[model samples]
Target chain A: MTRIDYTDLVGGLGLVLTGAAVSYVSISQYPLGTLQRMGPGMFPAILGVLLAGLGVLLSLQALRRPGSRPDIRIFSPLFVLGGIAAFALVIVPFGLVPAILAITVISSLAELRVQPVSLALLTLALCLMAPLVFVVGLGLPISLVRWPF
Target chain B: MEFLANIGLGFSVALSLTNIFYCFLGAFLGTLVGVIPGLGVLAAISMLFPLTFHLEPTTALIMLAGIWYGTTYGGSTASILLNLPGTPANAVTCLDGYPMARQGRGGVALFMTTVASFFGASFGIVLLTLFTPVIADYALRFGSAEYFALMLMGLVAASTISEGSAVKGLSMVVLGIIIGLVGMDSQSATVRFSFGVMGLLEGVSLIALAMGVFGVAEIIMSVRRVRTADIDPETLRLKAIKPSRDEMRRSWFPMLRGASIGSFFGTLPGTGPSIAAFLSYAIEKRVSRTPERFGNGAIEGIMGPESANNAADQTAFIPTLSLGVPGSATMALMLGVLMIHGVAPGPNLISSQPELFWGLIMSFWVGNLILLLLNIPLIGVWVRMLTIPYHILYPAVLMFICIGAYTSGFTVLNVWMVLVFGALGYAMRIFGFPGAPLLLGFVLGPLMEEHFRRAMVLSRGEFLTFFERPISAVIMALTGMILIWSVWSAEIIRRRRAARAAGDGATTHEAREG
Candidate 1:
């Protein structure tokens, strides 16, 4: 027989860990009063246990019948995530225009190889459009350009 | 009659110049987003959530409603042309729409679907007009126990009906509830899970959760499939839009049947347009004499599902407007908009805010009419819109999402939340868990908790109070039945799949022996 699906196993593990973390926080941090007078943490603690139980059930089911796994590429997520991080870093200090340009050019790299001309054109278009639509039209208070230094 | 008077009031409000302008703008923008694959109406609405923050509630709602239905009209464009669905609602359209396009009947298919959509929407609007008052009146008597039961039913139905592993869907729902709990505990005045972050005190922004999971995660998934060259949209001749008489004759009843099915499912919480569309398609397949034509560019294939989805979109507002229980994620977003404008939606909303209710209903008719007019002649523009490559389109979507997230609370913290949820959402997708339930869970979680707490308090913490109340008992019984039905159905599906696999294996073995 084919090997058991590692993806479901991993998913089951992740869910269990998340449930455990929530349960831990709920138990340690908050007050869980008796059944008659439920405290703030009572509901969350119940939900955490439910989640962990479900995860365990899923793991057991996975052993009986393996499921299909998805193809996970490494670089695309990196570039996409990196682009958002770049925007977050720049939006305050560097300003809207640079942030837009950074996010646009950086995210386009998720396609692996970017056509420089198209990338530049997209950057220019976004730089104009973002300011016009967001700042000028909608009147969000952000300067067009700023130098962090 | 009272109905006529209400209609008159609605028309007076909806026909105002300002409302018209907003409606037109929403339809135009909604079509643009819907035509572009990967930008579903939920993401688009969340991305534009900031834009409406400044408008009057009525105008904001009118525009939002326009966008919701407009997307329904425009979602079919991509399915017809590229076999790609702009939203889950339109996914069924690709079965025959692309085939029809390949056979050079693309224009005709588009025209028929548009007409079918209008028919279905009109039917739904009529139902909405008649039923909203009745449902609202009935729901007025519901106590906390009933409301809790209803919300629980909605969550369970959503988890089971969503197309994936039920366990994973339920887990996601629980996860969403946990996420919803990540703010100040309103009852006790103690901070629950903010982890000392100031942003968590106010709660995780809905726009961030939506834009991240639906918008940003979609971009992440689409990265691998990005084609450098855009599709040629001009090849489909726009002039060939007229349907043949035979096709027209076959479609009318199917449209009506589809509308009825759509309306039924749309009123039920947790069931949305996608389910309505698929169910309508299945019904059409079963009822048709020549069922063999269904997958091979059949006119019924395009007409039934398209109409059903559009009808479903309209009737989905029934639960949201009257009961104040959003039927889907998009409807939940609209509920958020209502709350943002300080208009609490519930049984009392229709009575307290008749102008808002009637005006919104009237605006739906106007919007659908506008969508019909817009879709017919503007097919060329939408088709041409397909030529824009994903690389360009996604960056623009990402930028809007970032801006929208930031604007949700005017804090950068929400933008950070977007990144975190986007990664989490992508992981969910990789593991084949349905995101819709997660969204529904997030939207309804806080409300569910509040109702549950209130019920518990009233009963002095006796859990039996849930079953003691008549309405709550009936609702809970229904929820239980639905859960059992879904579990049974899932088992049947698995057994059938296994049997098919075994059959194939046996056939291969016999072939080798022979």
Candidate 2:
């Protein structure tokens, strides 16, 4: 017998878990008053229950479909997310230049075929332009150069 | 006479040198980003949102509105030259616009789209002038119940009409609402889902969310499929831009039809430019005598969808301005900006802020004119932009997204949030969830909750008050009808597929028996 698809089942499970987490947080962390004169938790708790119900519905729908293998990849998401994370981590302590350089170099690494010359050029261009646009034109408070050392 | 006086007041403000320069700047930047394949108008606007923080509210709105419509004009450039849609709304343009380019008519296609876009913008401006006052006046009668019903209808429309599974879209909307409900509650002053972070008190920043979903996600998507486009120089010849008399004749009615259709859908919340463009293309195909000529560079193919997209881009402002309900993510961003500036967008906005409304209206015309001037004679510049490699472009775009997120609240937490949502956005793209509905839900969540709470309070805990009010009841009924219709349609489609499969099985069995 052909196996029913679990791709959407996984999605449904994710939704249910998220919903459950939200509901738990709302119910326990905040006060859920009566329906008419509601507290902060009332709306979120309602939404959370509704989400869980929809997640179950989605899982049921997924069961009727023919299963297809999932495609998995790791590098692009990792490097791309790492790029932003690196920028976020560095921008405060080390400031904008290193952060901008780090993001440019790291994000470019996500490409299947990375060209070193172009990456350097991109880094150089962003290093020059980021300050011009964010700092000079907009006069944002962030400094261009601040080294912890 | 009142209309004329109002317009005169608008012109007086819009014609100021400062406003005109900013209007031109907006148009220029809009076209610049619109010419890039993965850099959408939303990304561009969010990246530049901080620039407008210093300008007066009216001027800021004028510039932002310029960017919105200017994108429609510039979106077709990539479609014509590289067969890549510069924006998602321009996807329909590629059906014929690319073929026209392959046929050495790229110059003419670009020129015709510019004219069509101008016609569409003019039509939408006329509609905006005619309808805004009427709608605002009508909206003035709205109580809490009616407002609640309307917002619910909008939210329902956004989720159901969006691409992918209705259930999935609904789930995304709910998720968005949950995200929106985070931070401190206005009434109870209770922190709902901040996880005890001090920065979450102001709520998730809209700029961060936009940059994450649109900008950073785009960079990630483009990185995997990055290729440089080669533009044919012959297509940019000045003489090649002029269409023959027959081509012009064929295009005239399609532009008008497209603009009319666009204005209708654009005024309806949740049905935005992409849907309008697709609908116009479908209508054009159905109406055309030579439907067979559509994919082979039919003039109507480019003219209809191009006009419709631009028209929709302009008229989408109607709900945002008059009703305080955003029609699209871009409109939501604009609405957000208005709120940030202490200007409320609602029925009272027209009476209270005549300068802002009229000046913004007038500036759209000036912006369209600037776009025409920018896109037509300066076509060579935008075409050249198509040649920049994805490797170089994505990094620059990523940098801007980072800065945009950081500046939104000037907090490191916002940048971190951008990273988190960016990864989620990429995942959603892979899984076939529509981002626009989620965005619309996020933007409107607080307003919907506010209206819901107010309506309940007014009714003294009676849920029937929503239906007791005539306008609210009618609106809610409309929402229910749409939900039912989608469900019915999904069932029919499922049944048809099953029957087709069964028929195929029977055919195979008969062949084996024979």
Candidate 3:
């Protein structure tokens, strides 16, 4: 029954602060004249202002209206959060193929009660087929595969 | 006449065993994705984009197009069964289809959606075949200022359709523009947003950005949703999977109407199926005899939107193929594919590559036929997908995203961006803002900037040149009118609601209070 809408407000405010921060840093590095002639920073600064304005509007709307009640956060529940962190980590070591399979297996383990046997099988098949199709078949030039010795 | 001759050659090309197989594969997967909720052709296309590199260019384009149309049919299936729309367009179908499903007429709903989708797609393709040449020829006359104005209109129309406040949509558009600005300046070749990162020199790869923003983000969101849900799974019992004669007769008119509505929007640069579906729903409701039966369960709810959604899917290709402007993300990807194939999709394409153009049109018909044939039998298969617990699926989806991204370039930057954007996407979803406008903005941002800088250069920094050209002026005027029109409509809704609230008093307040 509790409908605080605090998350909405916080999100909006966070976006505004981030936009402001991006703008302040960019502007300090350059100048208004840098944006005057539609230079490198001009558009970004304008966008920053627009984002901040929208964020303010969103926060105001949240203040006036309540939203759905969310459940208590349960430590990111799924193994996918761990999968997420490792998603970027694996790309370099295992190469794109192994990295992706690890990501899929780990991420699925977090949310679903996946059978490790089936998941491993599916991942291995995909790992083999995807790179074959992309890197070998299509000549994508990704550094994921090597010819068997 | 030459074009006609080439159409003959295109048939020869498209009829090849290789093309036929790829086309079938595309449509089959497309329908599969459409039936399964949370994953649509967008994710499928991204995951599969790299694979296209291995095939013949024409074959790749053919497959991608099949998936695009195929996804629309799948959306209808999910809408009819679980009341979960596989695509945003199918949301309208949930109104009537779900009720019919509850009434054990799920077969009728599915049958009606299939027929209607076929009809709508045919209409859209007919329009595409007829109008593209004339439109592209006219579009060729467009200067930089006009191109700038045109891209501007597309961004505006896309943002205006955002689910929440227009301001938030605009914010997303601006964010997209900033991201697009990250590479070397379009005019000056000066590095911006790079921050001296060596990998950023070539700018962000299209595959990376797309996979990150769409593919990875989707998995993250789906993961969160699956983890959070506590509901027991329903043992679905669909009695029949075919339509009654009466249901078919009743649905025909709405199908025609939706197709007509769909193609009109599809031909435009900015409008897409999200708008088409809702418009069809509204039209059907207004035209229905007992509007009271609408949300409860009505065939028009399924028929109208289903037809229009499919129509929009096919015809959205018109602008991308003819005018070199994409109206949606899928179209943009297809456009990118076209470019990769050494075929720039613009005014010249229809003339230069008649087989490519006509052949694609022919394949659409083939693809739609495939969808009609495939959807009914596959319902059981897609329904089984619901039993596919989250534990096993998200990782597979994530792996595809990473592989697709990394395939574009051998850099780790692609993976990093996907994670970053995935988080951003996750946050945005919770805030009630729609993702479509952001995608539209990102796709169009670079094109718009290139046009703008070109215009400025041509006119020696005279921004007024935008209004000087008649085409540019008309486009800008249309954009302004749309912005004003949406705002006025929102205001009207606000006032009407206020008046209704005052009249109904405390009794109505408690029932629907959020």
Candidate 4:
């Protein structure tokens, strides 16, 4: 007997749910005209149904064999994604310099060992270099430093 | 002859001071990123894409194309030295190249691969020059039916031929198509999955999607994983790069064979340099008289794949330029760049924009020559770059991704989109679903729907019109065969594994009875 692969099962179920939701929304919200003249929703509705069918097939296939489990790491994604979020939050309000410093400090924490002096130095260099390259050289419209208040 | 005139036109444009300067800058940056172990060509291109907005369309394309082909040359340096591919296309090189490095022939490997790359690029460029006009002339006769059929074949082939579960790949393509539908319905002027968000009216930005998936997601995965490799400085010296006459003689035939194979695959839709490199390496191993020496520092192994990838990189432009259908995700991004510049790529592109066509081809020649000159003397500088730690690198890369995403739309919303897609991309990677097919689908989805709707209207709702057309029928038949073959082969492999397991179980039972 084959072992149940939970990863495959969950992934397939997620696909099926997404497909079903898309199909439902497409059919209900928009018009599906005749084959000669397709409405806006016609292509998406067909695609959603096909996706659901494929998802069913995938789930069935998983029952016949085992599949590899995903290798999940928390540290890298947490800090890396966190850093991007921080930059997005800081950029408009605090300007380019603070945004650069924000992302650099946050993302550098993903490394196992964080050197304080080097981190500060790296942030300082980026604050100087990013503006020169992006603002002065490329002439992007963003400001170097701003106060929204 | 007209060919000579065209060549003259190409050289005139390519040799301009501004164009030459941009080409050299592109080659230099391409090598810089390609020599670094963690950075990839796609990430580098997307990060620098915003800078191109300020330049003319022709210059932008010339620079990007330079980067595309230049990376193939620089990738082998790291493969030979550290057994880590600088880009995915060079992964095959590490097998034989690392062994050669251990034997103190690293310099020779680098020199030969560079020469082989130039030769392969020249071969592919010659083919591109000869065949592009012919293919474009033929494509000019195609209608909406023919186009829809061809795009369908491209989507099917791209998803199925990739190295993973065919179902998962197909599902990802479908998901991308749905994502492509999120803006407005162009035909009917109806709002779609936008859900009243103002930003959704213009649809998802391709630059944001590309940078999020290829740039940020990659950084997330590679942050803690990659380590700097220690190098032996003596192996990279200029004096150590000279190869024996025997090694030179043995490599010529393999380079020819590899270039031929690479050209063939490169012209096909839904395949690119990585597949070409792998296939050529396998072919070289099979045709060798002393196959046992393959993994033990064989020069042919490194020569064949390196040559194959460079050739593929050059020829991949054939279909994209002639048919307006990209073979891979990177090609799709290039197409996006052209579209953003208000240039539509299709059959008339060669006739209408002769300068862009010929000039780009001539620049390939110039770019390859520049790479050949740059890579040899810059070996010491590149090796020193290997010592830069991952912690510092990832942070800087992250900063670029943020700035790039922001400038693409000049909105913080685009940055948020990058984060959302970055998380989606990372999750998809963990689930064993390939991202390239999804990208191809996103690029082609809207175009495919437009063609499909047009074809339907032309046929008066008769589904049999697809079968009635000669070209469409043939392509549709090929797509069907590939689908059936993939499913049948997967089933056969599964049953064979089960039988082997059952055989083992029976033998153990019989032994216990005895």
Candidate 5:
């Protein structure tokens, strides 16, 4: 009995779907002229088809071998990505200091245990450092604080 | 005399106070990141890339190149003391380096690796000096067909030679090509996969993509498992670093051999320091009289791979600087830096921007010397850095990534792209796809398309044009061979695994009957 690698199975399916979607959009929307004067769609259409073929091959291959299960965690991605998202959302509206604070507080929660005092200290330190380093030292035009009312 | 004149010009540019300061700063930062586990050269370079936007093109490149090779010098530090490879290229060093550390010879391992790295880098730099001009001259004659075939070979070799499923790797390359198509088509002005977003018109930001895949995703993966190293401070003292005469004797030949191997691989498109290091270790083990001493702290083990990786780091510039074709993702990023600075990289770049070319090469010498100084007496600082908790490190790194991405274009949109790609990268990691090939493909995608389209147009739609030109024919043949060989070897490995499993099962059944 051969074990199916769920990772490969899922990845292959994802590739196949993406490839199909890309190819469909490229073919439908753009003009793929003859090879001599190749249009915008020609290269992508070819690449998309090639990708679909490879994905099908990968899916078939996954069933032929026993695979190890990878240890997948949700806690890290949820917080880390959430932190970046928060920073992005806040950087424009709130400003650099608030954005840094939002990211620092949110991302620190990714760790299994967090020390409240250190997290606060880190946030404070970053609020000072980011402005000094990115704004004053590098002269980027980011505002330290802004009220978007 | 002309060569000497060129060397003198290189020194003039490299010795300028501003360039020297930036070079040192780049080396110092590079070593800092390389010594810290979980930070990679790619991430560090990408993080600092925005800072270069303000500088002269030559100065910008000198600093980035310093970081590029400087990581090789510092990567082995953690490998020796903590048994953690600071960069993937240094992973082979841990087999012997860690054991040597456990035996209180950590200083010797660290000192010798630095020496080997310096020697290897010098050897590579010499080759770069001699070969780049000649290669660039030869490359000036290349047409669209030759360029297209060569890029195809690079893409194929990069994906196939990397660890894990070649199919998965190749798929990632194609996916990158798709991602690269997000911007407007250059030839026809036709907008691509932009999905109606205004930012997408400029295509995905390279800095955002690099930070997402290499920086943010790395933090996500390593946040849980990164550990602090417990070091004996005594092992880092200057007196403890001197290797015995016999140990030094054994290491010299291995370093020489390793540098030779590394330099050869470095010039090849798609191969880089990690492959070079692994190969050097394998060769050293095979050639040694006592192969069993490998995992038990043989000096040759550390010397060979350390020299190999560093040498490979230096020589990897040859293809990039001469042919405008990068061998690896890091080289691709360097190329991207050049393109961003509005300096087109190709054969003419060497002649047109001789100062940038020669100055960068010469700066490698200064940077390596600086790294030697930093890694030796300043070793204590890096060791202390190892003790910083992951809790503190991850947040700061996350902030840097966000800030770096945002600064690349002064857009909040790039930061959001970081999050999106971070999720995508994390997912790819779980599914066994490598990020390097995707990056290499992404950087090369547009260039490859241009050359390919041009070639087809020139050949009047003849599909056989790629195989017609002598240089392109040879390159295309090699690409085909690599594809077939990778598939064949994969089949062979699968069969061997199956046979071993069957054998194990049969043995268990016999034991049960007995």
Candidate 6:
């Protein structure tokens, strides 16, 4: 297997540069030491350094030697991804019911099975129970439908 | 004597019928996930966090604690049986555990791990009783610099101990830090990587990230073939796998050693149980008379690491409860829960809120008792979960992850973030990068940012104040050393491997002459 850690090395180095840029930007806004005790820029600047420093170390390690790189397989299919995407796409449009049904369908596909009846019933139960219990029961208002509701 | 009193107090609250039922439910759920390969307690906790929105704070908390420890016990079962660990902490168990299974000693390994978790958890319960008040108070004195330094040290340790190349591990940590930087800027309240997305304003939910990276990534990894391992029906016979008298004798010291190391390390900010397990495994191997016996079904190896892992898991709660700083992501979420309830956790909690404090402290004991009962009797039930086809189980898990991530903020955008992270996580894994550090960063990032701002406010922007504070200075110094030491160790390993290769070539030539 080809050494795969090198990719992360490159990615890490890129992050360091980005972190430096972010820190620099944060420093300018807060004037480095503007707040005496707890300042806005202080934490971001320090954290930025920590982030970059970690990236640098990782990059060096990756450079030193290459090890086994397993061929990456897309873990979940486009269907599973699509399931999540559907949840996001339809969440506000169709409401939690449609969104949840998408999630359950794609998820059950992990077995790669489309147990339609079970999926439908599961979706129905959750869609009703979720809003009713979390929103109505708790009195935290949520729309049964999205924007239209 | 006080141990008994504290334990009695704990039982009073834990034994409350309501609390007990929740505790059982939490433990059962925790164990179920623990048995599922790739679904971990860390993600599980985040997934379950929303479900507790309706429960009373105390009941919710006690149940969460049950799940936390319960998962540890559950993970050991998977490692011993299938070689696939249920939780990250159970990785150490895989060293000897898988070998034991291959040798048909799976039952023995399972039994030993159970006893170890029981004792180790008990030890942590004792430590929590005696030391929580004092430690919590001492934690109150930690300043901003100290906290930042502490987070840095943890990141370093996590990177150092992570499986595979240390460099890749460090890279993962950096990646996590960057991910953490997403959302609203702590000091300025400015939108960051959210890219003007309203869902991004709340920052990336930890649940989404965790589910994406761990939950979804794992499902992708197993897509090639369902990882269905063979189960020997004979292995289920309890009598088939009892530890021999000699094996039992050997296990005692390692368990104690594990417990001790776990307690000590658990007190530190970043050195959580997972690290403690690795450290204990190394120490146990070094001290053993026959070190070569490890990684080959050695009971001592499993016992020592498994016990220490649980001990560390339990005692880690001390810092979070007493002092406001949580040692891990789950604890951080717990902190959020506490804050949500209008409770500020600090040193004076034990005295100021005795019922809440003592009640929780005491509940640990009851939780441990419940864990043992459920873990043993239902071991078969958990074991049976392993045989359920992954195709059936994983989808439900995916459902849980999706719903859980969305429920983190009741937002749709967060679901997308989870998917993106799941891809990134899978890529990182194939690339040999570690994910645990990302979690550490997520857990600590917000807090580090908050403290940095506070410290500046207090110090009037004088950067030198961080160094001036003795506690903070020492912490930063230690972090610096860890970074340096990890680099040095990696270099040495590289050099040694190179030298050994050359030596083998030379020796081969000499052998030809002989």
Predicted model with the maximum DockQ:
5
- Best-fitting candidate, scored by TM-score: 5
Error of 1 at B367 (Å): 0.7
Q: Rank the candidates by DockQ, best first.
A: 5, 4, 1, 2, 6, 3
Cα miss at B129, model 3 (Å)?
A: 0.5
Stronger candidate by TM-score (2 vs 6): 2
Query: Can you rank all candidates by lDDT, best first?
Result: 5, 4, 2, 1, 6, 3
- The TM-score values for the models, in the order shown, are 0.96, 0.96, 0.87, 0.96, 0.98, 0.84
Expressed as tens digits, the lDDT of each residue in B206-235 for candidate 6 is 767777776777777775466767688677
DockQ of each: 0.66, 0.65, 0.37, 0.69, 0.76, 0.41
For candidate 2 chain A, which ten residues in a row score worst on lDDT? Answer: A64-73
Using alpha carbons, what is the TM-score of model 2? 0.96
Q: Is the docking of candidate 5 incorrect, acceptable, medium or high quality?
A: medium
Off by over 4 Å in 3: A1-42, A53-81, A95-101, A112-149, B224-242, B290-297, B339-345, B494-514
Any residue pairs clashing in model 4, and if so which? none
Model 2 steric clash total = 0
lDDT digits (tens) for residues B465-495 of candidate 2: 9998999999999999989987787778867
If both were scored by DockQ, which would come out higher, candidate 1 or candidate 2?
Answer: 1
Chain B TM-scores per candidate, in order, are 0.95, 0.96, 0.91, 0.96, 0.97, 0.87
Between prediction 1 and prediction 6, the one with superior TM-score is 1
Error of 2 at B314 (Å): 1.0
Q: RMSD in angstroms, candidate 6?
A: 4.8
Q: Chain A TM-score per candidate? A: 0.94, 0.92, 0.73, 0.91, 0.96, 0.67
Give per-residue lDDT, candidate 3, residue B74.
84
After superposing candidate 5, which stretches have Cα over 4 Å from the reference? B506-514
User: What lDDT does each candidate get?
Assistant: 0.85, 0.85, 0.73, 0.87, 0.91, 0.74
- Per-residue accuracy of model 1 over A80-118 as CA lDDT, tens digit each: 878888888888887898889888988888988788998
